[model samples]
Target chain A: MDNLNIGRHISGQFNEDLENVINHVMHMGGLVEKQLSDSLKAVYENDKELAQKVLASDYKINNLEVSIDDECTRIIAKRQPAAGDLRLIMAVIKTIADLERIGDEAEKIAQVALESFDSKQQDLLMNLDNLGRAVLQLLQQTLDAFTRMDVDAAIELHKADKNIDRNYDALMRQLMTYMMEDPRSIPSVMSVIWSARAIERIGDRCQNVCEYIIYFVKGKVVRHTSPDDM
Target chain B: MDNLNIGRHISGQFNEDLENVINHVMHMGGLVEKQLSDSLKAVYENDKELAQKVLASDYKINNLEVSIDDECTRIIAKRQPAAGDLRLIMAVIKTIADLERIGDEAEKIAQVALESFDSKQQDLLMNLDNLGRAVLQLLQQTLDAFTRMDVDAAIELHKADKNIDRNYDALMRQLMTYMMEDPRSIPSVMSVIWSARAIERIGDRCQNVCEYIIYFVKGKVVRHTSPDDM
Candidate 1:
């Protein structure tokens, strides 16, 4: 091939690598979202099987993170792309961290559910499920932003995280009220609180991913920066 | 220069760059620690000036973050160092994010202090100061780990974060109790709860830095892996 065509061939391979990495990320995201969804249902219905599934999938998620991390390193070593390509690699590394944390959160949720299996705290489970749904929505939005490379959508996810925070706070207050009214509710309420906190953390991780998308696309650190301010 | 001398020259320059990055990180660490310290004292003693100082210094800390970020990026772009050097750059970038977030948390504490300017929540402030001290110690340990590149110390910081989590839970319980007893304590107690949460977040950020240190030296992700397990 001529020099120009050689350059085109390399660029084609680079884009292919990017696609593979992004595909892996989306697959991992889907698994994590399923884990969250199932873990919440497990908690609500006391379905130990679903909870165990979520816990088991954590190892898979961890493996995916390691593989993706290795892929990122290999891509840089092999392609030696600069500037924007480098930033995309950096974003992949960061996105892996966030995705792995989401897996951990899912595992934590399962563990909490398993612990609360014998309790008559279905109400607390309902609250946790609600929190999980809100967090799941945030994660979905964040993943969408990454897939589309939509900075505005990523910003929207960042803004939506504040609502999750507010919801978390309200859930905490409700749990506190339940626990104070009846000390017998303490253990169950505390478990739910832990789950809510974990889900809220998942939301935070999603927002972290959203911030990475913005940074990946625009080289801006918009983590704590509000959308209106930006 | 011969290849041997060239090797030594690169090594020396590499060490010097590492030192510069470490020093900048330490300076940022110290600034964040002081901001946390002063913000706690400001709340406890109702020192508005101290709070204002903490808030004002945040701009400098933020500027420092951008500068350090630039230096690390510049090193990576110019040197294109491989293996450990590449890992160091990655770790420094991640560390800067954690340190910047710690600064954000300090700013948050200062904002809370400023908002509660006329409030009389001395008892809550006392608890928050205790919690803040705990977080500062965590930050200190994280900094020591970074300076020494001590994986064991980093592991210890990761484990120590659990203690901060427990302390935050206790604080949350105490605040709930106060709010339950007297509904009027809701607003002030809520502020105290948030301040304590912000300080706890700093501790978490410190642990995150420690995790990056582990990745820096060992090239491993300890997200779901506990220190004992490691």
Candidate 2:
């Protein structure tokens, strides 16, 4: 990841400060990844304690975001970096926003895990587990792509988000069927639906991060650009 | 709101550029406000053409966002303005992101209007209308806060978002009851649920924009700080 090597255009304290900001971003990403993983685990195991822990840890992620944002602003004000350096700070600022929102989504998923669901709905749980694991993998790869500054990898991950969307749609359809068949299960099924929506949104956020990475490295605005064109 | 003027430290082209960006932002806000209103009307009137127009107009909003972001980056690189000036640019950048997202949410609501719902669900539609109007008003007031840089107005709008959340929760409960009473309505009810979620998110995004206005005007990181303290 360090081999990707930004801030080479500037020297001395600017380089060091840039490195610190990157490190903080990667650290925030690590925390968000864990939150997502733990959130799914809580849902799968029905562990209310773990769910509560995920909720409590959100403040740490939020604090990290605020600090990282401050660091970016300070560097910009002090260094007055231009071109690629300016873009790097901008990218980091945007990426942290997405990371913070992803953390919020993870907290929502954890909240759903704390809800009571009938054991008969275990089938729905199994499906949600599959979707959660896939989204978790996408998030992991997206972070790795960020660390590497790998545009190709980022593009690939952008395409991968579509699969998560499909999975979410399929799960929602199945959940709807369950609700239709057993009206008593509507509340629990709705929880699963909400969790699926959160997971799907995480996929979208991961794609946004990937877009930022591509922009940072290639100096191209790949956003709203069709994937096939890339 | 105008009394909360920023970028007073450095005069000339920097101020002009900052003003240009702010004007563009307020212009974008007007577009988003219109989109939200038209989307609600589409749902209420079952007007598919109006919904399609809302969806089509999103590209224009997206283009505006890209251009405003480009202008901000250009100003930072060219001017290298510090302190309050730097913070003002940062606030605009963040605020534009939120505004773009609000446009996306409006598009989602417009998409829901394209879906066919039974006449029996008219009651649910009325509840959604109430929720939609409340969110639109919040968005309008938040934009007004941005234009005026009114910290007090922004703070008041921040508190108002909670009402939208409560209204959303109530509407969801009612929708759930309807779904349970008649399984045949699940598909249409789910569309309403999704649209309502999008509207709820717009309120959140509008609050975020208001927070940025407060930060810009007061140079305070009021986010995550308790409202009681404010």
Candidate 3:
């Protein structure tokens, strides 16, 4: 909040509106974070009830997305936000889209928990959980970076996605080896593959969130920049 | 554009700006369409050069996205447009983001083309080609709907995504069967899986674009709404 210098505005009401929107973003981020965490826990522990709860609660995240979107639109029409303030609104709009997509991925993971898996296939779930946990960490750091608008933390979090990608590749290779050993395990393992893909995408969504934060703070469009260039 | 009624504004300059932005969106959409088409051709024909061309041309789409975003920001600041105009601008902002991601998926698919595959594997590429062509048709129809701001067309296009999803699931099953029949095919088949996923996502991006068109015309948010509800 200090990084935003939100209260320095002459119009206290304008400051309040900005503060409210920012707060709502953080709140929404928290809800999405919880959803993803519960999704991961649901899969690892084979907690179908938790998975059901995660799926049921998805609408709340979706509702928040639409409402926050409306709030930003109202602010734009009322405040006519310029430059930095405008960028902040733009970032919120973009961030919420990514967050909503993240929630969708979480639902996909929760669905994975609902499916029955044999004891042998349980090993694959552990690998997915490893990737899931790494992604959850990335999502947490990303939300923290968004809260502070910390460009440095955002950059670090951005690089961390590569690790998640590497881990995802390793997990994919392992799953393939398992499939090679037992073609009978194909269908169940394919579900794990799908979950792994979703987890990898969550990492991507977090990276996109980090980019939004950097854009809000630095006014730079870092997308499409080669990793080597970065 | 008639559905948009762009020229109704009292300010000719404002109308010009609106028209210019919409035209740019159509231009960008056209470029993305070509990128997707080329990537599909590159894969089916095993044309590495076409794939390379698609990859190289991706930056143009990215650049357009940033510039168009800047233009939308400028318009909001300059016009302070309320109601419909605001919605149009918002839709443009959202649409460009999807278009950019669609370009990313196209890049993924093009990269698939760069890898050499046995003639038997080429049959899998043909299956992927069928999905790719369906998605390309959806993309074409979506762009057409966006250009006209046709709500009915948008609704139809939104429903079209289900067909893409079903096709994707079938493709996944086929890929799984292939891997199960020949375990050594796991690694190579995995790349096809990745490409199919990307193609499915392109279908999703097109659906999102259609949703934007619906939002612009119907003044509604259709996201998170179940199909039965829709």
Candidate 4:
């Protein structure tokens, strides 16, 4: 019943390689999780140094993505895995891509965080911080579901993404109203909107990873399907 | 030298299947191109009908993406392709993903177009229209480069993405100024900004497609590389 047991029936080396790739993916996921957290902290605390660190660490995430992709390519060429194994590799490839993009979004938030605002917008930052915490939780749970190959957990995580979208829409309306009230705060408010967008996108990416987990577990293509049906 | 000649040296059925997938991809690309153009027209003319059509047609694009992905999976499983053949399938998979996301961006723009503006923002729409045209051109050329497997053409298309970024930044500044000048216009301007962001993302997706072309042709990892080095 465990989908994570993929490649167990295959050659020993193939199983080992698959395990290595999964470990690497988990490592990359951990790095991405930290990047998101650091980026949010940078924005909330207005810490330029932390933001700079996020920017610098982005290259490491990028390198990991390329290496993981290369490993997957090598496995496909060498093993010619079919069915479940093939699906796993495809899912990993897709997951790493989403992870790398999440890293990019984090970097964008960091860049915005590094920019100077005329005054600290405490309430706006508080709201963004709450949203960031929610997204981070979704991401962490998605990764756990991936590790456990838990379809139910994956589906639950996928549904959680709707909440992130709703929060994003509400935040956008509030930011727009703030900008309208005081045009002087327009630039700063714009930065917050952009950062929130990056975080919102991370939530979407987490949903994608969850889809992959479900696909790997159930051998079903649940993407683009209505949540009601799910 | 012709990279489009991929899978030519393989089995006849494999070659035929590859051709069919490529044709489907090209067909999908054409549909996406139309979607972008129609969404732009809807915005420029404030035509809700045109925007509605774009939204309605998005499902077709999504279907194509799913079918193409299924075909790729089938090809990999049946053919057990190696080397260049494997790379070709990988590139095709990556390209279709970017193509689907481009469709999503177009849909976002269409959704924005469906929202009613108090008065037509002529100057702003005109600028957006121009930028949209430029992005459309880049997308068309990128698809052409894919069809031809022209590395030089792909490289050229990659360089063109920079212009889209510059245009997006300039347009953001203009939108911000307009919002500052008239607080009442903030909501409409926000929609425009979101739409413009979608267009800008299309440019990024085109760049990704170009990178895939380059990877398939030259076996190079051109992604995340600096333009100066490219």
The TM-score of the first chain in every model comes to 0.91, 0.97, 0.98, 0.96
Which candidate number has the best DockQ? Answer: 2
Tens digits of lDDT, candidate 3, B25-141: 999999999999999999999999999999899999999999999899999989999999999999999999999899999999999999999999989999999999999999999
Tens-place lDDT per residue, model 2, B1-230, is 35535456456777778788989998999999999999999999999999999999998888888899999999999888777777788988999899999999999999888998878898888899999999999998888888888889999999899899999999999999999999989999999998999999999998888888778778887777777786
- Which structure is stronger by DockQ: 2 or 3? 2
Clashing residue pairs in candidate 2 are: B1-B148
- Each prediction's RMSD to truth: 5.4, 1.4, 1.4, 1.5
Q: Score the docking of each candidate (DockQ).
A: 0.18, 0.83, 0.79, 0.81
Q: Compose the digit string of candidate 4's lDDT tens values, residues A75-129.
A: 9888988998999999999999999999999998888777776554778888988
Considering DockQ, where higher is better, how would the candidates rank from best to worst? 2, 4, 3, 1
lDDT of 2 by residue, A1-230 (tens): 54346546447787789888989999999999999999999999999999999999999999999999999998988888887788888999999999999999999899888988777887898899999999999999999998887888999999999999998888988999999999989998998898999999999999999999888888887777888987
**TM of each candidate vs. truth:** 0.78, 0.97, 0.97, 0.97
In terms of lDDT, model 4 sits at: 0.89
lDDT per residue as tens, model 3, A1-230: 65788877788988999999989999999999999999999999999999999999999999999999999999999988888898999999999999999999999999999989999899899989999999998999999999889888989989989999999999988988998899888888888988898999999999898888888888888887776665
Candidate 2 vs candidate 4, DockQ winner: 2
Assess the local accuracy of residue A137 in candidate 2 as a C-alpha lDDT between 0 and 100: 98
User: Which sections of candidate 3 miss by over 4 Å?
Assistant: A227-230
The CAPRI-style docking tier of model 4 reads high
Give me the overall lDDT of model 1: 0.76
